[model samples]
Target: MKYAVFTGATGGLGTLCVKELSRLANWMVFAGGTKEAELEKLGKLPNIIPVRLDVTKQESVNATLEIIKSYTNKLDAIVNFAGMTSFTSLIEGESVEAIEKLLNVNVVGTARVNRTFFDMLYQGHGRIINCSSESGWMTPQPFAGPYVLSKYAVDAYNDSLRRELIYLGIPVIKIQPGSYETNITQQVYENFDKTISNTKYYKKLLTKMKPLMMMELNQKNDSRRLVKTVIHAMESRHPKLKYRVGTGKLLAMLELLPEGGVDVVYKLIFGKQGHL
Candidate 1:
């Protein structure tokens, strides 16, 4: 039987992906990071196997490996949905520790998870889907520097991995989702508030960015299409190298602008405070 693994399986988008993938009768889904309570709530859905996996921890990775080995030796696909987000401003001299933490989870941790299952993926001629954000390509939003930096790294890592594994028939796919319904915005806002309270600088700029952040959060697109896009990437015989889901024409066009052009646009949008 075809088998797959999805890291960050308990997240908002991850949960949707898992539920939809479980409907595929021919495939087994190893829902990474799921808890016992979640499994019970799922009520023994066919082909959905909940496993306690955390990409950041070696022991958790090892346990997931053992669990997968007990069921199937090959993985047809591995979707990396695990990620970290933070609201940080470079001008504020954001915490080095926070930036490192995001990179470790969003970049290094993802690399480790894929490397652990590399052999199985090669044997199965599997595909890898990494869930990146629109921030991966677009200009960085104010006070969201750390999360944007991590996603930029994710984009580069996906490109390098795809090229590296090409000879082995293991395809790497990137799914860049635009604002979608998730708790990330809340977390980032909370972080921003905490940082502002603790810091002496960027207070006015941070305050200015608050309404914009709230507007962005309110604009979250339904993630159903993103889930379908991921499933297609997994099942398609010849999937595209990158899938940009939910990014509207405006944002899409903005991505084509030169860095200077984008910078101008940002300045216009948020006035002098928008300089990246």
Candidate 2:
């Protein structure tokens, strides 16, 4: 039986991907956050086994992997959509510790997943999808420093691993979602506020910066786009190296702009983000 695995099965895009992949695979086993309730609900699906997983912790990841490894010797696929975001501006914003957490989950955690399952994917010639960001493209967001940096790492890691795994010929596809209808916008704003209250760097400037928070919260994209993208990536006769989904071609054009120009343009567009 072909089995698939996924991370971040409790939330927005993760939930959508879970449903879509579940339909395609004969059986699906996935990992979730600290919440046991989420795991319980998700496991109720027709052929799903939701395991408690904390991607940032190596030991926790190992323990979860052991259960999965013992269950299935042949794994077909894995999708990484587990991520967190904050609206801290680099020059004048939140704590360094927050940024550290982002790197741990967004960058290191990703590498860990691919590395941990290297043996499985190789032996089975499986596929892996890394949920990258458009911000990692030529469009460098002003207040989204941590997110951009981590995504950039994912992109590069995919490239390096793809080359090394070529003898195995397992496909590695990167999915870049522009924006989708998710409660993440509200969540990020909440994080921004909490981070700002205790932060001293740019408290005054950020206090007045509520517009950027609302703009991100209001940005819209179709959730179905991700479902379609994932399905295509899995079933396509010749899956491309990367696929980007979103409502905006603006960021596409931004990808063509030089680094200097993109930076200048963002400064003109958004005077100040979550940073002072």
lDDT of 2: 0.73
TM-scores for all predictions: 0.90, 0.86
Error of 2 at 152 (Å): 0.9
- lDDT measured at residue 254 in model 2 versus the true structure, 0 to 100: 68
Off by over 4 Å in 1: 34-36, 39-43, 91-94, 248-257, 265-276
Residue pairs that clash (backbone atoms under 3 angstroms), model 1:
none
Q: Write the per-residue lDDT of candidate 1 for residues 155-253, one digit (tens) a residue.
A: 999999999989787889999988766767568778878877875656665677677666666675878889889999999999999998877455577
Candidate 2: tens digits of C-alpha lDDT, residues 34-143? 66877787777766778887888888778777888888875677778788777776655444766788889887888888778767766667888888877656466656
Which lDDT value does model 1 have at 94?
56
Number of the top lDDT candidate: 1
Instruction: For each candidate in the order shown, give its overall lDDT on alpha carbons.
Output: 0.82, 0.73
